[model samples]
Target: MMSNRWLILADDLTGAADCAIAFGRRGLAAAVTWDVTTSGDVSPDDSRPLPVLAYDADSRGLSASDAAERHRGLLERWLEPDRVLFKKIDSTLRGQPAAETAATMAYLMERTGAAFGICAPAFPATGRTTLAGHVHVAGRPLEDAEVWRRDHTYASANLGFVLGTAEIETTLVPLSAIRSSDLASRLARIAEGGPGVAICDAETDGDLARIAAASLAVAPVPFFIGSAGLAHALADTLAPAPTGAVHIPPSRSGSLIVVGSLAAASRAAMRRLAAQDHVVHLPVSPDTLLGDLAGRADLAARVAAVIAAGDDALVEIAIGDALDMSLGPRLARALAEALDPIATRIGAVAATGGETAAALLARFGIDGIRLVDEIEPGVSLGLTLGRLSIPVATKAGAFGDAESLIRISERLRAVRTQGSFS
Candidate 1:
């Protein structure tokens, strides 16, 4: 058996939830936590010796050097003999992936005599793939995607160049080689020889599975890196057993869908959800919530009233002409303050954007989340842990299509808000 206690470290909340949910689905008691001390929280019911622990470093918005330093420190503390470490990076290659992954590799090498990182950042469910070291989206190079053009700091989509510039020694495992059965031996040799990073190519979910199985076939398992796809594969190979049934209580109130993302996919989904007849739309200006106390109060009351009326409500931050990136944290805090008073009345929540979800959970005093299911490719549906235990659906800002929000709202309503109203 390839059983090992798993520790997943991610840059943001959604990444943390999605990656952790992989293990959760495979019968390992898994929880996602964001702690100032970098320590993780376990579920109250979990008594397993090595319950899966996924931590969000919240370093997506930090500088490369700062992010790298944070990961190095975290790795030093999380290193354990019985634990398997997996660094979770965005499937689309967002954030300071190069810096973070390199830092993880460096720290692992120092802690263990021999360490090799096998990184395959492909999540086929969401149309992300790697071919010949270059990351692509929907068959096009990532540079052509809207997200890359608007927010990317990298000059190219090639993982080699990205990691190379960060001074991380990496070798590419191409598609042809990845499909071969000898991959396990190949990876094992790299792990025993010296410190090196293997950036594997994966265009489909099967590729990720093969890579994961091959990597595990080795004696000393290599440190894995990727998104939910790789995490799911690892869980399948190691924790392949059905623990039991997951009980989710039905909700007596309508669900709340919160949108704090400015990404095009999120904005489009927001609009689609607003058009639904069963859903009520409540738009709050980010500036008004952050600056005007009266405006914030009025908006909160309106949102609360809508939820109280047995109708699903879509609360979104209206994007205007310009977005002030510096006010991001402040806006999240302000929104959380406005919504905190009525959180209990809202049965379930579907939040888009990581910072938004993190802020709201923190305001509610939630320390961790026990993941239960994935509504879709990137949407993680789970129950909060600690202070509150309401159902939550977390989605990354740049993921999903135009109708994603509507689908999520309907699912939450069915699972939580629908028949319980009686």
Candidate 2:
């Protein structure tokens, strides 16, 4: 059977999500994934998913050769090391910038069969920026253009696409090709959207929390925003909720849970909401954070611990980063009383300060991590272990994520429904 998986070469995580939205518009369930390189700061109790992943400068793999090796390993784990796609945006820069992008593209395409789509005018509507900071297929270069087109406006704008890009195929949304939109309509659609899941991966808490609230406007499902940075951004809004807080009513879809951040007050409030409806352990408490992790410091230590513990042959062993105080190791130690060696890969989604996260993961000696291009800079939407083979993950406290957190809840629900794993 042909694989239905769709991969995108986006400028950033937001770009990845936008592309996923495009895929969703084209009638497909899409998830914008990122790899975590930092330490843990998010958690999930009875609700939420762990965020994505990232690797900051502190990682031992920061060296050119090490980074390349890391990417190669990841590529081997996922797509072919050489057959991945390269998506480029258009802008203006000098010599080496363009040369490097082209060289990288050429290397991937030539050695890996990954041809690229150079978008001259980077995405206009969104804030996606060109990495090389230059233009591609700009100006009069549209002589052979097909799917690509011109962009009207952007920070650095222009437009073009590959000659015959396929549906969901790799395409560049240069700063130029981005289309503008009305804030009102966008908010309305998001608010009125059906009950699924509302995810916020913005760089700051204010912007992301605002958007997260908007997603909850008309939808009755659980609302989850990745990354504490974004969560704190909207802390005020989420705390009192202007559009109104829809308490976790029994009639609603899923319970509300905020993982990934130690914004103590906010996490407490969310749990209180869930408690009102008697929803099973959502809105997790900071006190439950077993490790005595007081934010960044705690997370860093967890990363070091994860590295030292090693993946070994244990199946689970909390297969993730250690968020909160109740680390995967401690949890594992406790589980040994009755459980088998199946590690759960826990506490993998932590999005504290970039540098701090870096320190933690770095100390962990996780020699195989690398940063994803889109989730690198400019665009935000921080999620820990957001995308990877990690089977389980959670935010530190009430900082909720979509994929990993939901998976945990759903699995538990299923286990209860079917006889008893308990």
Candidate 3:
């Protein structure tokens, strides 16, 4: 069978790239675009429609109503009958997932006559799983996870409760039904009634695979609501097709590594990466970035000098104990502005946070990313599409290990040297 065309919608840049990379790895051309207001913004190329197109609504940090409106507007313009919808949410239940899902369901119902959502946000490879309708990260409930403590929109980790905030009717499909022989029938029964979501339980890749298969077999073809793990499961069920090849940009200079996430995993990875002999760590305080233009310029110059010297430059925002989450976007924009001058001096770019990656790419005049491969479980490697067509790797704030940044840096360098992932 020919591969299905997908319209994957994510709330952030990293989520968009990672989920789209699932199909990209399956040999389908996948592209991710952010800040999309017009239909033309999502086009990967003028030649043809891509097999998988993931659009980042950039709504993760927005309020519930605003996030819902964003998703509705995008779907209004881009939701086609032939294209399958995959609503990508954070695995750890961050951002405005409840609002987003409700918006998606309402739109799909209005447009397609019926709609049902299949939510399975478990990414086993990254140590995230859903059991009893609650998301677990590395064997701990999402409520107890560091990411939730740092940032959360819900009172509980239960998927049902989260979805309930938006008044979305959800059915919890336990592990028993997921592992049973008549899984498809069970899903069909749940989706039989008018618009409702089913929160499926999954502990491993195999369970996710089963969920994907059963959901596909059901009527109305329920729109997916999950993370990259579910996207991977869906991609695995589809037969591989030879699509257009991704263009790999040539290496120009040393790679630029930017980490703007406050997650402990990202901070640890940044430290490990900075320890490399060929890497120079350029740490700037949030205060300096937000206020001191001269300091920002000097930091940019230092970054350029490091790249000119054939050494990797690692740019990180120094966070203090009294830091507020509300300052994240301003800090990200400031950091991006500081480094915008050195865009031409870098060969490849690796960013750790979603907002950070989006800001830097926008500042550097990048329209979108054409995903090519996954460097690790949650890290995606792609080539930027506009003024700067260079290798860009993105990782979520809470994903990956201490050595993840090092591995990503090496991957970008290798791609620069080889001209292709092959």
Candidate 4:
């Protein structure tokens, strides 16, 4: 039997939750935790080891060297002989994926004397695909996507080129080979050649499944690298027995919807959600959040009142004509600080963007999230495991459509009414 132990390392909170929830949906107990220090909280329930534990290094906004170091530190502390490691990278290749992948490979080589990586960063369900080694978003090359134009560390969308930036050797496994019957043997042969990363080409979930099976068949169990789509494929390969039941806490109050993502998808979702009669839209200007404490307090009070009256509160950061990507983290922190006073009044929460989710949960004193179910292809639902225990739905900034936020808010409300998710 394959070892059930698995560890997923991600650069941000949403990546960790979405990847971890892939296993959770397979009936395996999974949890996501961040801010992992030597003595920091590691899991929701440490008494019994979870089958899957995803940790966010919170390095998405860090410099390349800092991001690499953060990943290395986590691996040194959390990696174990019994656990399989899945290094999660942004589907759009937004952050320092090359630095982090190189760091991970170096650590594994040092520990086991042999380390091979099989990277398939395609998440076809969300329109992210890799063809001829270049990443595409919704039929457009990544370079042409809004996300890449707004923020990108690489000059090209080619996977090999991205990995080469860190001087890490790579072999491109074309889609033709991935679809062949002898794919397992081909991948095995590639691994036998020595320590290097295989950048696989995948344009669909079936392609990713083939890659997952082939990678697992290789000796030494190569570490997997990808987004939630690849993680879902791996989880299917493991096929752990599902747990019997899940306990979801009851709630009588309204849900809190926070939007701090700059993605056009999230902004559209917020707009659709605000159209609902029971949701009170509360928009906060970036300048007010950063400079006006009185204004921030007033917004928080309005949010509390709206929730107190059994209505969902939608809090969003107002975007202007041109906003700097660098202001994301600072704006997220400011939003979190503004909402801190109303934490206890919130029955459930739905947050967009990793930084926004992480900041709010941290400010609310949450240490971890015990993943229960996936709300959508890339949206994860969990129960916060510290200071306050409540159902929280998290989504990557660019993963969903206009109705995504509406579905999440309704799901949280339904869970609260039913008093359980399972």
Candidate 5:
């Protein structure tokens, strides 16, 4: 059960980075892939010694069937004899967790003759916890959160009900049992009992630690299914020791901030970051970027010029009074395109939102990223793979506090002054 190889699959870039950071924090070399098409070009042996490979399936916006199929294919291609499988679900359950988990279960059963999956999506550090089989955010039901309220497909926050719809059998491990001395034996029994998913309840890091311990103690190591929280617990118990302090040399120039998420938190953070005297705020509207090619070019030039002048630039998608969900993806791609002209000039790229980060990095031909640090509970900082070696920071659209953007900007600046990404 104690192995360094891990195939961590996530639905998007942010999810991939957050989960991978759990291992990186433990001193294990972890990388989050951006493009799956070129995944074959890199082998597990080709990466860092005993590396943790995290792939972004990019299936968040796909249909349940498509997402499931995508994960199935990934498992077929990447799952190896010695590698452990970790399916990273969104902490807030934003993606098709039940369908994808079922897909993972099917593949694991076929490949390893395993029949059970240990499901624990609680990320206590970010206010996401599970209790009595339901997922809660900040003490409220997940569906009650702004993200789910705006766009949700699940009938309820109950993990059992959600997975039941996908025909994936599940069992709940309550907190009471988790805190008890018999917890380890209970989990071992569950593993030996049958093939199904175990939905574990956890309100704190301690609960997750117990679940992880019990999992490893079992005969057949169950497939792990959860967010960064579970990953953290597993990393602490299973991953190798750190090589050294996690450090990335600072950027030589000012950093670039791209905000394309429509989440209220992102919008508010941009406002606060834009007001900083040292920050140069360049707002890009979706309409102009989509329709006005010349104007888009002009904006890109200005953003590049500002960075060249050693001034940090905040290039954000302009959101109007009316709420238009359709504009989100388009604006994300547009903003990324506009910044393509100055990708190299950017000392570091700090993006908010998975779509935005993916679009922007793909433009620069970045195929993957090596995670090295965690800026906060939900924010991960790393260096881009392939041609670009610059430090990069990624945050989920709805994650982080009001000053998250500010904190990223400051971190990048500190690195810039430090000389090099270690």
Candidate 6:
């Protein structure tokens, strides 16, 4: 019952919501819930559209069985094909409650027979709202300001659990890493300088009012919710600004880094283009950010130590295609081809045009084996010779597990737009 279709069970409500938004964008009707307090409810149709549901903030702390039963009711209500049912839970190996979250997952998976995946995103030694919230990202002279930044806002690192009765397996790798160029570019574009608008949870209805206010505050170019779906929704909900386009007015944004998954990064970049006509080819990755054994000590640990100390660092690594290309290429191409074998293939010679992506390359494969003599599939390398210049977060493109790629991509795009560093 659970092996055929794709079932996605998000570890946390936000993960569920975000994954649903991803589905909605693909034209599939989906719903997401954050409040997990009580089990029985149609879920909130406000923060999200009908196809996209959000849990009431108050209903987020229910017993696992109770929550699971309620979710069953919700799914029974939405008995439509191509419809998604999500339950996000946090796990505690040491405790039963979090494990109860896992119980909720087990129930949804067995009952719905939906194909899904799970993601748990947590920042152990990081600061502020480790997961989801406003992050006052500053670089260089702002080390002392992180305290200020945290005071001003926080982020949510609540576990992202995505599960469905689908074939997609959940393999989450904690890769809180990104390229420098990617990070720097991200900050610049997002702030766009001056008091820009901040759109919170635009994936839901109440968020619309929030955006309206944000628009009023920022005027015209409202800073939209970070994810692509919310951005699209905001653009649709608001009257086309005088920028002349149905989209947010184009910005003379400096540069932006497209991090995370290539597909997500590419979509984020494409969505934010005020000047869509202007061809902007952001660099993408087909590897891990903190994957495999090498990443832990290789890049992640090194960067974590630096940033924790309030120092800056930046690391660069080369990426290419497989079959005479690079390993990331081989893995990316394999996965993409599996998703859709009809994808076009580039020759062994030149770069695959200016714009390269993780997803598109995933048409090939994403798993590369590492051989000391030769860096092949399933292999990663690290070099830490550079000065601790800027508090840097370096990760191989393939570091994060499968489903997390989307969120990772969103984060990368956000950081890139913020242009915090360069």
TM-score of each: 0.94, 0.28, 0.97, 0.97, 0.94, 0.23
Question: What C-alpha lDDT, on a 0 to 100 scale, does residue 96 get in candidate 5?
Answer: 89
Residue 384 in candidate 1, Cα distance off native in Å:
0.7
Comparing 3 and 4 by lDDT, which wins?
4
User: Lowest lDDT 10-mer window, candidate 4?
Assistant: 35-44
Q: List the residue pairs that clash in candidate 5.
A: 27-242, 248-421, 249-420, 249-421, 249-422, 250-415, 250-416, 251-415, 251-416
Across residues 1-422, which tens digit of lDDT does each residue of candidate 1 receive?
46657888899999999998888777777878886542443354755454688888888889999999998887777656777888998877778998998788777766766667888999888889999999998899999997787677578889899888788788888999999979888777766667778889999889998998888766666788899889888888874656665556666677888898878889998998899987899888877887898898887788788878768878888866378766777888899999888877887888999998999888978778877778888888877776677778999988899999988887778767442211
lDDT of 6 by residue, 244-284 (tens): 11111211222212232222222333344322322233322
CA displacement after TM-score superposition, residue 202 of candidate 6 (Å): 20
Query: What is the Cα-based lDDT of residue 67 in candidate 5?
Result: 96
Ranking of predictions according to TM-score:
4, 3, 5, 1, 2, 6
221-305, model 4: which lDDT tens digit per residue?
Answer: 8898899999999888876674755566677788999999889999999999999988999999999999999999999999999
Score candidate 5 by TM-score against the native: 0.94
lDDT-better candidate, 1 vs 2: 1
The lowest-lDDT stretch of 10 consecutive residues in candidate 3 is 35-44
Candidate 2 structure quality by residue, lDDT tens digits, 93-141 = 1111222233333444445353322222233222322222222222222
lDDT of 5: 0.83
Candidate 4 lDDT at 265 equals: 95
lDDT string for model 5 (201-230, tens) is 999999999988888877666788898899
